[model samples]
Target: MLEVADIFRAHGPTWRRTVSLSLGQLKVMSAIEQCRSAALGGHVLRCSGCARTEIAYNSCRNRHCPKCQGSAARRWLEARQADLLPVGYYHVVFTLPAAISAIAWHNKTVIYGLLFDIAAQTLRTIAADPRHLGAQIGATLVLHTWGSALTHHPHVHGIVPGGGLSSGGERWIACRPGFFLPVRVLSRLFRRRFLEALTDAHRRGQLQFFGEHAALADRATFAQWLAPLRTCEWFVYAKRPFAGPQAVLAYLSRYTHRVAISNQRLLAFDERGVTFRWKDYRATGRTRYKTMTLQASEFMRRFLLHVLPAGFHRIRHYGLLANPVRRDNLAKVRDLLHVAPRFDPPSDDTVIQAQPVFICRHCGAPMIVIDIVARTAPIRAPPMSRGAT
Candidate 1:
């Protein structure tokens, strides 16, 4: 399969000299290019049962790398397994308009942070209204910066349980069957809160502008630019509630650690440019599935556009799911619903067998590390010790 790393390794050096990239983007390119290659370090493993040996290279483990997210997602989901409730779960998405996305390209940390905060606030506020569900809800929100076509589309996918704890925390309050909050209400509230927050950020000079958006540096010009967005509908929608707890986990695994594109989608890579499958969401039926080809440089540009600012978290929990009180909150919720806790403490007499990190492909036996290879070092046999006759 053609991978993003292939494109990066082939074109990255020349492309690096042609365009101006941020420190973060450059680091991502370098990491992806060297991943699982001799450029990075590796370990030689010997199978205990047979005489087979293999070299296992280290992964880049960058969150945005297409090849690295599977294990990362699995590990994350394992940690979250105990937090799942027995109730239905809903998938809600809050998307920023094109106007805001343009500015976000210039002020990622500030604007993206605002998007997370404001979306969480919108969901909690609506769910807590006496006229609505009348309870406080928890959500796990994951930020996705690119659309199917690798265009700069900023949005958050929220996984929310169908209900929440009541005001007194004594009982569970479930939303109407087959429904969460109204999409219209969520959209309106999200738009107002986001615009208000954006204005405040501008006042505090927390935002930046470049190229044509440089005019936004002026207070009046920025305010006027945001006027139309206030009246327009911001895309906020809730998909059907998941079938069950297992279904929710399946969905989360696919979305949580996804990158701009995956290697499985690549069809070809040649002088004609890189070809890949992309979904045209605007179309329906089989027509929605289409192939696209972009110059290798453009493909790299679009891929790197999603490298997040350092230390900025793309996944966040809010309300009852917030890290500080998640354990207590989940305990209270499981009790209210009369569902058994997902985890039980293991007894001292129980024996736990840990899975081996590496297994030999030639023989069905565990592999043991025999030697280590330094980064950028030649992969030749290690030198013999002084008395090894």
Candidate 2:
């Protein structure tokens, strides 16, 4: 059983009584509790070699449920393998200034969308400049709203093909083997574009603030807040180029379908509270794994804060991979790279058939279910302790 199950089993009822009565948290609790358990159904497998039997429970398969992401990650990796191109890939991260995080929390849909737009536009615009790459770049951007400690830290992780087609489509602009775009320029352009969009949103009344950030509600106050942002160093960190296109797809496999936390990271749960390991960037030397204790209600609040609106996509494709012209552009790219178009055969393995389950937990030998545990009804209480009324 996962730590989340133990935590939920112990405190989940109290949380339902204290917090907003909603199905979301309940469903999450149910998924976490039933993960890797027969309650959600399973299979019985019998080994022929030794006549050993095993019972394996199925996973909830919920994206937000930590226990289910393992297989999801694997399946995603396999699918991405087909999209890999034989070219160098770049890892570019775009992060927003801290001040915007509050407003982003309130208007997640709008601001998150803006984050994607600005990042994509900044890259495409820079790459199109004749003095720079002067080409069209293809990339995938994934939005991550939480840091390791479950704080509201939003950023975009982009895996870009290092080289691209020239403006006239006559030649390719292959980036320097070790470099893609200059960080300084990318940072400047990214800051300018992002701030400009933010200012526009503020003017158009698309942003709202209250409580601690209420001062930002005033137009002049907001301008003052935005003024220092440009001078501040907006981070645009780029990792060394990946060996080739296969690496790009592989990198996406790790980040694209990821959730807030994973079962493996959970350490333990007890009567005091829940404890889990998280990365603390502030510390020096080896990054330390720290634990946090929270009341069940507080935990539920923090966890549910990350549930995105329905149908909002956290992963997006741009440039050559954009849906409208993906096939046509991919063909052109294959021709330019001198690689023959290879079609992937229909996959027979994607049909998630039931796995056989019939196994003994203590020994490898086959075991039969000889008994069933049934719930017993509560016994009627004898007349209440008679204190003469």
Candidate 3:
């Protein structure tokens, strides 16, 4: 299968010389290019049953690398398993308009942070309204910076429970069956809050502009630029409640650690260009599934456009699910809902078993590391023993 790593390995050096890229983007390219290759390192393992030896290379483990996100997502989901509740869950998405997306390209950390905060605030504020659900809700928001076509479409996917604890925290208040919250209300509030926050960010000089948007650096020009976005509708979509808690887990396993594009989506990478499957969401039915070919350089460019600022988290929890009080909040919620706690601490008498780190492919048996392969480089003499003369 054609992988993003293949494209990066083939074209990254030339592309690096031709176009200017940020240190983060350059690091991402290098990581993807060298991932699982001899450039890193590997381990020699011997199967106990078959007595077969094999070499396994290490992964890059960069969050932006397409080949590395599966294990990352699985680890994240394992940590989040206890956070699930015994109620329906809703899938909501808050998308920034194209204009904002353009600006976000330059001010990713500021704007992306605002998107997460404002989206979570909108959901919580609406759910707490007396006329609405009138309860305090929790949400897990995952930031996705690219659309199916590899366009810079910034959005947050929010997974919210169908209900919340009452304002007084005495009882559970579930939303109407089959529906969680009104999309129209969420959209209006999201638009207003986001623009207001954007204006504040501008006032504080937290936003930046370049090229055609350079004029937006000025206060007056920036305010004028944001005027239309205040009135126009912002897209906020709310899907029907998930079938059950298990369904929500399935959804999270797919979306949480996804990179720009997966290796499975690549169709061909030949002289014509890099060909890949993409969904044209504007169309309906079978037409939506289509293939797109872009020059290798362009494909790498689009893929790197999503490399997040160093240390900026793409997945976050807010409100009741906030890290500070998640355990207590979950306990309270379970009591109010009369459901058993999903996670129970093991008693002292319970034995904990650790799984083997590596398994043999040829036989169903555990493999043990026989030797470590250092990264390719000049060989160094082994250190002398403690008693060496």
Candidate 4:
């Protein structure tokens, strides 16, 4: 099983010398290389039942590191569990055309922000219209900027309730079962709103261009560039409703914290380069699942293409679920639907025992922390000749 850390530790230094990287990229590479290694420091875990000992290295805990997101994803999912609504949940996706993908790559913050804002606006406006659902909807929007082949494909995954509150806020208005708003309506609205927002940003000098797109710095050139996209059919899809609230949570767990690639997908690394698996949506059967080898440098470049702008939020909630009034809105909707309040229970007076972070591999027994480790001190390594316990 090849790990992302193995690739970085082996070739990262050479790649760093060859290609320039942003501060974020550098930090991400450093974090992945040092993750779960002696460099970051860790404590020793002694098994209570078997008397076996092991050294547990600490993780980098970087959001971008593939090895470090399991615990983070679990924590985030736990927090979102309470926010689930007991109603049909629809999965909506809004994707930008290839023409705009170039501009988005260079001006990620401005363009991506517009993408989030316009997509959310489209959903809210369409749902509020009497011709559509005629109600105010809430959605959790997650931004994904990469395709399976590691290309720059910007899209937003929206988790929306099948219904919304009426304009007067008096009652809940539910859409027909298994179907949400029309995709055509959402697509057209998203295209118009996104173009309007992008043009506004360009006019205000908020967008930047380079290389072949340098001509786009001119207003007329940019307008001409965006002309064809105005009428083209933007990709907007609505998947079938989730089975239940638990299904929604399960879906969120997988999508919300994903990176461009995971360690499991990595196959091997050698003088030739890195070999990894990729899925081709355009193909079928065995042909769809194939492996490709790229020069280590090229692989790193593709991975770094998705390093988002500093402090740019990739996950957002809008409409009824927006942060400003989420609690009050949830309460109101729950009351209208006659759903009972669900929350964390009060802490009991009983003293809880601290749990171990790792267990003994041999005996499956609890491994208690016997000593604390400080980073400045020497690495506490286990005996080199110890037999397998």
Ranking by TM-score: 3, 1, 4, 2
Task: Give the 10-residue window scoring lowest on summed lDDT in candidate 1.
Answer: 377-386
Q: What C-alpha lDDT do the candidate models reach, one value each?
A: 0.90, 0.74, 0.90, 0.86
**lDDT, residue 261, model 2:** 69
Which sections of candidate 3 miss by over 4 Å? 377-389
Q: What clash pairs does model 3 have?
A: none
Q: After superposition, how far is residue 166 of candidate 2 from its true place, in Å?
A: 1.3
lDDT of 2 by residue, 141-167 (tens): 999888887778889999888888877
Per-model TM-score, in order, reads 0.95, 0.80, 0.95, 0.92
> Which of candidates 1 and 2 reaches a greater lDDT?
1
> Could you give the C-alpha RMSD of every candidate to the true structure, in order shown?
6.4, 7.0, 6.1, 6.4
Per-residue lDDT tens digits for candidate 4, residues 109-158, read: 99889889999999999999998799998999999999987889999999
Model 3, 90-151: lDDT tens digits are 99999999999999999999999999999999999999998889999999999999999899
Q: Candidate 2 at 250: error in angstroms?
A: 3.7
